[model samples]
Target: MDVLITGANRGIGAGLVAGYRARGAAVIAAARSGGDVALDVTDAACVAAMARALAGRAIGLLVCNAGVYVDKGERLEDGFAPALWAETFAVNVTGVFLTVQALLPNLSLAEAPKIAIVSSQMGSNMRANGGSYAYRASKAAATNLGRNLAKDLAPRGIAVGIYHPGWVRTDMGGAGADIALEESVAGLMARFDALDMARTGEFLAWDGREFPF
Candidate 1:
């Protein structure tokens, strides 16, 4: 299996890339910082060019994991960096849209393609709260985008799935999260192995349980 992970230079995205690579799966790691496919998820033209650059290659998995936070869980207009909110969504939501649009053609060449939009429970409309307003809103949009994509791509045999990585201990998730990075990612990959059209379009937790939208 050949896998592609956006934001592969750090955090869960990095772990996913490493996890797949360790399994001997051919991995195409994409990141704004460092990866085999260097890309800024927000740039449509760059995304398209990257996809074309990978043309004719097998891409069995696409981990749409690139995202951003509004620095300190703060929202613009009420915060110092007024532009932070838009920048957050640009990378977190719109970026996912353009990246996938760019990669779909390349992905169609795969035999059993899967697209996992690594999401979060902060996106849960049923559980919405006050903190991290910009981050929460963008992820919620990304999750919905994944749901719609599942429907649109079903005809092409591409399964689109969403996930909540939980309050992971990462640069963005702060230092107090409960689960270890390895544990969360391991559980999610196990779920990935069992997925098909039957279970696509669902929001899943890193532990493989379904999250209520």
Candidate 2:
């Protein structure tokens, strides 16, 4: 199997890439700074270029995991500064949309094509507690984006889903979160492998439970 992961330098994205690589899957990792797949998700041209370069190669798993927070500790107005919100959404939302759209040609060849967008519980309106307005709004959009993509792409046999990795102890999640990055990533990847057409368009937790949209 072949896998493509975005924002794969540290934390969940990087760990997931490592896990998949350990399982012997050919991996293509993307990041703004650098990684195995040095493409930036924010750049449509870059994603398109990378996808074209891969051509007819099959990508069994496509993890649209790249995301950012202006700062987890501050209020969105300052933490996700007005200026930064644009870039953040460009990376966190539009990036995933464009990357997946661009990679469709390459993804079509996979025997079991699966697409996962890393979302957050902050995006959950049903259980919202407030704060991080920018991050929450952008992810809410991504969650729905995954749902729409799942429905549109199901006829082609590709399964698309969104997941909340919980408050994983990553740089963005900070050191205080209750869950470890390894635990969250492991559970999410396991769920990804077990998904099928019936589960498409769903919002699920890392531990394999479904969440209301």
Candidate 3:
């Protein structure tokens, strides 16, 4: 299977690249820098160029994993700047849409293409805590994008699933996070493998539990 993962230079994205490669899948690790393919998801031209580079290849899986948490510790009083919101949404939400749009043709060539969006539990309305407003809102938008794409692409034999990869110990998740990177990667791979038309548009966790919207 040909799998392409964005933001694959580090953290969960890097682990996913290794995991898929270990399974013998033809993995295209795409990142803004230092990856198999140079792609900045926020840049439409870059995304288009990447698509052109892989013109005739069938992509069995497209992982929209590129995202930012710029407002991680911003204060409610004076934090969450306008620029931060724009940057976060550009990468977390718009980036996903652009990548999917640019790669639709490649995905259609596959027998059963799947799109895995690495959203977050913090995006869930039911699980809304407090801080990281921009990150939370962007993730929610990403999940919504994935859900709508699932409905639109079902006829094309493409399944889309939104996932929360758990509180993994990565730069984004922090060292005090709940699970190790390997554990999260293993569970996420299983989730991606289990995705199909019947389960499309569902919000799920790394461990396979349903995540409330």
Candidate 4:
């Protein structure tokens, strides 16, 4: 399979690139910097340029993994500034939309295209922990976007799946997080491999459990 992954320089993204390569997939590892394709997902022009550059390449899988968690530990009193919210949402929400929109043609070239959105369980209203408001809200929006995209793309033979990649030991997830990068990557690959029209619009955990929105 040919896969295009964003935010693929490090953390879960990097691990995913390695895992897919090991499995013999042709991987296009895109990043904001230091990758096969340097792309600022937040920039519409940049996204469009990348898409045009890769116009005919068939992308069987598109993983929208670029995201920011700028308000991780910020308190509502003084932290979680307006600028931070905007920055986080730009990357976490708008970035995903732009990437998918720009790559639609490439995706259409494949026999069965799939989109995996690395959203978070924290986005679920049932899982609210009352902190990291910006991250939570942005992820929630991403999940919603993925669901709607699934509906719209189904007739076109493109499936969309949203997932929480677990609390991994990445730069954003921290060392104290529950799972290792390998574990999350492995689970996510499984989920991606199993993705199809029947499972489109499903919000799932990396381990293959269905998640509540």
Residue 116 lDDT (model 1): 91
- TM-score of every model? 0.95, 0.94, 0.99, 0.99
Query: How well does candidate 1 match the true structure, expressed as C-alpha RMSD?
Result: 1.5
Candidate 4 lDDT over residue span 6-55, tens digit each? 99999988999999999899999999897789899999989988998898
Q: What does candidate 2's lDDT look like per residue over 1-213, in tens digits?
A: 889898998899888988888888898887876677668878777888787788888888899999988745676444667777797789889999998998887679988799999998888889787877778889899998998999899989999989999888988888899899889978988888887788888889999888887
* lDDT tens digits by residue: candidate 3, 1-213: 999999999999999999999999999999999899999999999999999999999999999999888997799999888999999999999999999999999999998899999999999999889999999999999999999999999988899999999999999889899999999999999999999999999999999999889
Clashing pairs in 3: none
RMSD (CA, Å), candidate 3 to true, equals 0.6
> What is candidate 1's lDDT per residue for 114-208, written digit by digit as tens?
99998889889988977778778888999999999999999999999999987888887778988888988897798788778898898899887
lDDT (Cα, 0-100) at 153 in candidate 4: 100
| Best-performing candidate as measured by lDDT | 3
Worst-scoring 10-residue span by lDDT in model 1:
73-82
Model 3: how far is 13 from its true place, Å?
Answer: 0.5
**Reference-based lDDT, residue 27, model 4:** 95
RMSD of 4: 0.6
Give the lowest summed-lDDT range of ten residues in model 3: 64-73
In lDDT terms, how accurate is model 4?
A: 0.94
Each prediction's total of clashing residue pairs, residues at least 3 apart in sequence or on different chains, is 0, 0, 0, 0
